[model samples]
Target: MSKSAVPVNLTDRLSQFSELWSQKKVAVLNDYEVKLAKLKGEFVWHTHEDTDELFLVISGRLTIQLRDADVVLEPGELFVVPRGVEHCPVAHEETAILLFEPEGTLNTGDAGGPMTKVAETLR
Candidate 1:
């Protein structure tokens, strides 16, 4: 198989795979997959059993709702949801993001909604 590009145009990279929840392979490292995700609305409130996930906002805005607070993220800012914390992510408008997580992370760790990506596939 060929390698995906490392330096990518965020807009174009995300356009290549226009699917919610499913992560497209932009580039890969031994422990992480560089992903571009376009999201809107809300996601299920979930938690990872033992792995933390990092969410980087490349465009637009995102809100991470935890038990006690909501953390807002804007372009160029990133947020990390520690393992075992039940949280839900919401986007009021169209959002583009880059996420870094361990190789096998259930996108919706707990209360997964309709857009949850159950299986990890490198597209």
Candidate 2:
């Protein structure tokens, strides 16, 4: 057993931040990072050419709009956007989500802008 093996309480971690669209790193697995974010409004259309992105809705609703269609997710639902697929996430109200992606994966992906942010580790 190790300190890292301690169970993480997602709700407690989520309460530590309030910035919309900003991701907070909660844990890590292999070369991946498990992140949490509070989202609202529309996000920039982007693509992660190297790896897929996973989004799990913890609360409220989220819509992942792809070039061909829109994938809507509600609480307890998850969606994966494959690599190289351009997508935008929109949430009509405040939505809490869990994201699993490779370490160093940028939030904005290829559409870097002011909205882009480095996922900060939660303390």
Listed in order, each prediction's TM-score against the native is 0.83, 0.97
Model 1 TM-score? 0.83
Local distance difference test values of all predictions, in order? 0.78, 0.97
Query: What lDDT tens digits, residue by residue, belong to model 2 across residues 1-123?
Result: 988878989999999999999999999999999999999999999999999999999999999999999999999999999999999999999999999999999999999999999999996
Per-residue lDDT of model 1, residues 1-123, tens digit only:
334444556677676766665666565678777777878888888899888888999888999999999999999999999989989889998888888877766687766666666434444
TM value for model 2: 0.97
Q: What is the lDDT of residue 96 in candidate 2?
A: 99
